[model samples]
Target: MTPYQRWTLRTDATSYTVRLSADGPWAELDAWGPHGVETGPSALDWSHRTHFFTPADAAPAEYLPYGLRPFTGADLVASRPGEERGVWWEFAGAEEDEGALRLAFTDEVLGLRTVLCYRTVPGTDVILRWTEFTSSRELRLERLDSAAVTVPVTGPARLTYLTGQWSQEFQHTRLDLSRGTFSMGSTQGAPGHAYAPWLAVQDGENGPAYGVALEWPGNWHLTAQAEPGGFVRVRAGRVPHEGAVYLTPGETLTTPRLACAFSAEGLDGLSRVWHRYERHLSGERLRRPRKVLYNSWEATAFDVDAAGQLELAKTAADIGAELFVVDDGWFTGRADDTGGLGDWYPDPAAFPDGFGRFVDDVRALGLDFGLWIEPEAVSPGSELYAEHPDWVYRIEDRPARLVRNQLLLDLGRTDVQDFVIGTLDRLLTEYDISYLKWDMNRPPTERSRPGAGPADRLDLDAQHVAGYLHVLDHLRSAHPHVTVEGCAGGGARVDHATLARTDVLWPSDNTAPLDRLAIQYGFLHAHAPHVMSSWVTDAPGVFDPRSRSLAFRFVNAMCGVLGIGADLRHWDADQRAEAARWIARYKDVRDVVHLGEARLLGSPRDVTCGVQYDGADGRTVVAALSTGPLDGAPLVPGRPARLRLRGLDAAATYRDADSGAAYSGAHLLHYGLPFAWSAAHDAELVVLTRE
Candidate 1:
């Protein structure tokens, strides 16, 4: 008889434990929470309960197959070609190395071995979990989840997740689950704007929050089920194709990493845990400050020409922009979005005096040059598409569908991946470019590879994801100096995997002040500010029609990595001077805004909303805005709306940088920062130094 054995994985502030009971063959979660949670009695233990189903079905399993966990949903579902569909696996062995633990299980009848993997992230409350499957014989996996997390909730579970449409991405949503299941996912090839691959769960408003995020960039799903036996189980992983993914002999299939976090201080604290983990993912790249860039997409659109772009670059440089990007229309045949996507060379008609000369001219203005490229897409009218018609995805007998007048190149193919890599490499080599805006304007439509086999056709999503990642990996290694900004028609392909590769992410295309505030408010809950690339655009109103001042726009953009997308050529002397001043002010506080701990003050729903950043070096920066009409009567006759500060040294005193007024930290934390709104002073950028 195998005696009960347990293993504990710990981070600085949290602990996760797994145990194999002497009476059961599967591993189960013992405890998961604050640092000392493993020492207490597990709330998940179901050993004493009487059950009609198998013991493993009712237990808080780490990872169980369909046969053993027939009643409850299984983390893995597999079968042989002509055999039954379930895995009745037995315990094989266990291995532990430095902070990671691996538990192996084998189904001899199916000739398969499965290993559950766990490793605690250093200096964070996040534990990375995944599963590996190896088959001695060929097998089909209908469902292969990365990990199943058992939340320690005694009653109903409140789930907080992110969901929305394209321009309105990252809207926060909440649901309460007492029974049944709740699921969210994306089938749009990339992690679509409809739903993010993340979820946070807690028992009540004040309970500890448990969060999980999948590191997959392709089709994925996250499901939370409040079982009848009184516990919430969250299963997260990449969603397989129409049928199943084939696992041949000796070829191991490893699922994407699932990062699980526990925070006793609720969802806000859980966000900080995710932020630290993201910073760790960034490695040395986080050390470099995200530069202020001016993208010409909004200014000129497809009417891009060397002369016009040069004029914009001059104004951008004058306003203290560090990088100038030519967005779209630069390449040959691309007078508009319909014609020249695949042809990446600069248009001779637009440049007149060579693309190299144009790049040099932009750089001569003391700003680094950047270019936008949508490598995964090709216009039907493009030369590359006309040459390699077979490269784009299509069904043999069906008419090829075009989205945005373009077809998605079959990036899953090695030849297609090589072509993209070559295009980027050659462009980077020829031009003195320091930044690349990699954008995917649309998802793949009619996704199919004509000549592939029955089983191989289903693997298109995974293959494309692998191929996309390979291109990014090559870019990182080949051109380490170049900063890569990831965008998928704005924030569609955002995930841990993409975040690890790109320097920053463009959260949304709608830069209107109020709409962007709400979008960013939701975005900051799951992402770090450093990676959120926000722009100041001349969008009169994309979602909200309310007119906002230049200061309001600057303050809104200042909450993240700042950029200017508005046409600078049209700006008068006063507007340009104000913008230059705002740019200089942003440079002053960007370090604290990017590197500091971010706290979402009052939400966008509140009349007064803001974001506060507390730096490790004793500096605090806050970007406050009045979301509602300033002409409305005050809530209190004589009192100003206050944003109570958080994460401060209550004993110390903080002095305002603008007004030179000093206030005790206790008062700031309790009484909050005061703001009186008007048309001209609807937003404020406050820098506080602790004394």
Candidate 2:
């Protein structure tokens, strides 16, 4: 969606495919073709043809990031380099190593560039980041390491770890990247991880989904997918095969990275249907209006009453919360544990009047109505379960361990799919609900169906995962107007594919200020701030209990997605006032933060984390958060150090987060002042106004 004519960027770990078609009402740089690939314009005729599913085919048509595959004819067999199938998109511009190409598809429909090697031979790594802008932002491949990374996805089906020759897998095309130890060829048992046959990359009604038929060698998971800003990765082990594989020095493992520029859950799953979906995303960018909002569950407990919900909603609307989302606890039989899932109808006992009244009340306060749904989960204790106990998935003979007392519904099955789609479709039409938070609570486990052969080596993980993709796809198409927020045990399934559907995502369940400081730091490295959900919790000392200053909240809220989950209706006057104040402040600058460059001034390990935003007119906002007294000690006595900032307007005026006193960029940054927090003290957000 970042304005580009047509561009393809690929690396050892991933590839990017971007295209610009007819822009509505307005079009900026007109697209020509896949003109920027170094290898030449690839024959997209195959892409134009109805793609057939096979065990092997090495082309990069629906391949992510860029449409270029990592290797082709020459890459397959180093011995017969010239004999390798060569396809070109463009080859017009070149200077030996200059990154540009020409293409036969070089018409007015697309325009793209390619960055073939991340490590143009490892470490003297090549990059497209510093290139001259082509009316589009530059793309780059970065290497972020293992322990420093978190799982990426918005639901339960997520890969805890990943490794590779881990780049591209085009069905039976027999990918062999092995000149410098870059090859992916496994034997019968140790089948390498990959999307079998093909992966469907589609833009659904709400977001995007990379669908795979998922017949693979071994049980696997969708480990990670870091988009836009990109990610650093680790590889998974593959069974070695009989071949002269390539190696990059001592780097023994290899991997194919998931590409994105990604994330989404949609309201109606309209984007899932190929024809309508193609028409939906053929041309467009995500459109959003600024909104202040609040969510429950982060507030009070699961035992929320209509009164409790209404109390929170009142405070939410009063404090400018646009979409009042009542998180969890609305369905019949849903109390603490998820025993009564799939019962979408409201609990008539909880409120004599139904959710219609809840929607009406929220609307009365000038706010939109939002609800949460985990439609993919079915509990053994519910009426749906009593009617169809077999619908719950678990291996036969093995006691089904109650994961939150709920079982994952098989979206891959026709009857199950119909049931889920029916339940959600009815809700969309029945309620005037404007927003939904789609939660997936799936974990890695046995996915035994009613009659699927147990010894058939079914990739239950993959199939269950496929079911999730199907459910999300179906729902998004069903409700296009209802914005969804994806949550997977909090942060389990935070990835690029989910982002295309929903406007925001729950970054992690771990909201401890110190932990979140680093947790969110890594999340932002690959994702836009707007997709993240940030809020204040009981991080002692981050905010004075009676200060009425959401200093910590503003720091977390300002960066990406913003929300306060703690029960606000129970907060003291000061806490409530503080929350309200921070909410208002963000309303003033959300646009600037949402659309600016985010610069990390230091490593997340430091006692203090620094971030800066350089907006269009040179307006800069520098935010810093105190992690904690490093090594269990206080730093209150540390010197008032001056900070030399990056991405700052060296000439802009700066203001203190506390005093509002102004200082020139040169004066404040020149003197390195240590952060001013005691014990587990506060964090700060500073905005710089350029004159």
Candidate 3:
């Protein structure tokens, strides 16, 4: 009754087709994107052709099979209970169910079965793939991949992916596709701060790009290999255990789903596909109004008390902040990082009369209250840790390693999970808290478990991620009104996995605007601006230290969700006035900047550059920043710094919100407006609304 089959799967912009070889097994399928041509059906005979299961002379044309296939890019590799040979899957059947197509393969010798599932969204060119395995007899799997896809392209293809370390995550890198295997993966318990589980492949710099992203949050791998016949194979999955998983009779396992998309419209277009998919899933929250919040870390440090906080709150409220977050050091015995973790209670010294009156006062001042918490760590000096030393990951004889003077609490334990959930629940229920900044400051190390064998230790990494998600999910469900921002010593845990649950991400701990520009630029490439919370902090930059103007800082921070981490109590009267003006300006265009599609023009390395946000309804805003000309190159004699505006109707006219200057869309897109810089480190925000 279904029109789709094993032969073809089609979308509005692309089509995928496969046909059976003479022996009834599928051949290498042909994929057609907007830029690629379609291929004819298979014509090979079974007379002398090699089968993947047979001891073959070449790699199987079908999706990478394990045994006799010469292909190294395999999706499934396993053996039976008493056998030494690899799995040899035989073609069973293919059928369509609802909106999905399933291809089943079986091995009577090993009594193992696999189903290759595929589905295409109704209007998009994305293809979703995953694998399911079932066994009639006990089987052992050494390697199992979630999905494997092959793309037809010759030499000169380039691969692009994101890589960085703590405080500097999401830096984009591109490398030419070489002959051998190039993989980006992490085995350090998490998707890790080093590499993100996403990649894009293209023939060259410009157009016709293919993108792939793995949905798993635990340790994972993605490999792209250049095959012999001008084709490339990509496979992604949870890191397969070299030690094996024994599946009992009647048992079944399903791998994580992989999402793939293709666009002939270049990298930006490919990015748009991902953006659309995320926005569709997030719905209203993706477009919700973000607040201008003031975080009190840089202002007060660990010397926190009710009276001091109240004073800072008054100044923050006076300057038009809608949210006030009291970052670390609000809890029990908390003089420094080494003492008060794991004990999640209001410090008696910091809040002598309890936090109730302070919360009421903050509410009376017309600002929502937020709190910072690192729920997954413990300090050895804390009362809670002293009470429950077994709650953290540790080995029998090894000294527990500490980073940031804290140990990772094994949330994988039910008792630890309950305690975390209970603490967060009580906090949210007892206070007028409107936001929570959930932070994890250190990576997983010393990953051994007491009384557990080696096999169980191998699973510790996955259990930690599972436990973290469970806590996050439970808290969000119980307290739907509160917004949660994710931070891991700043930006280490910023990925789609955490982004899906949290309302915002602290992009970095270093918010000095000059450094923030590049950090934010790299972040926006894979993440939307709405979830990237960039703050205007007082700290000097990591790289540049020329004392940038406050206006430049404000413009750069406004490119994402705006937060102020400055000590407002110390700001001069003139500084306070300028701050108020910029805050007002940000409020006016918050919708466009938060919900609109962002376009970064020129490189962040360029001296004069801009970030533009184009709203769906024809409104636009451009924040142009200049730190002198590029390499001190003199300005053109008659041409100003021209920015060719994008995403405007060529036939329409627009008026500037401030200057009331009129310009045709054609003129703006062609000749561009003359952006004049008065001095070094100068910045200006330009607003244009179509008429």
Scored against the true structure, residue 292 in model 2 reaches a CA lDDT of: 63
Query: Lowest summed lDDT over 10 consecutive residues: which window, candidate 2?
Result: 143-152
User: Any runs in candidate 3 off by more than 4 Å, and if so which?
Assistant: 1-29, 35-63, 68-70, 80-85, 95-98, 121-125, 136-139, 240-248, 453-458, 627-634, 637-639
Question: Across residues 181-207, which tens digit of lDDT does each residue of candidate 1 receive?
Answer: 999998888899999999999997678
The digit string of per-residue lDDT tens for model 2 on 227-335 reads: 2111111122221121222222222222222222111222112112211221122123234643666777777656756777888888877766777777778778878
Q: Which has the higher TM-score value, candidate number 1 or candidate number 2?
A: 1
Q: How accurate is candidate 2 locally (lDDT)?
A: 0.47
TM-score against native, each model: 0.98, 0.61, 0.91
Return the TM-score for candidate 3, rounded to 2 decimals: 0.91
Candidate 3, 1-691: lDDT as tens digits: 1222336677667766554443334445545465234554322112333445342223324454567454465566788756775767667888875447788888888888888888876656677778888999888876677787666665756888888777566777888875777888887556767887888888767757888888766678898887555556788888732345567789897776787788777676676666655555455676567899999999999888999888888888888889999999999878988889988888888888889878888889999999999999899998888999888888788899999999999877778899999999999999999899999887677766676555532456556777888998987789878889988787767556677778888877888777777777766666677887988878897776656778888999998888999988878998888888999999999888877777776656766778788886778998887765433233765445766776678999988989999899999889776676655437888999899
Ten consecutive residues with minimal summed lDDT in candidate 1? 631-640
Which candidate should be chosen as best, given lDDT against the real structure?
A: 1
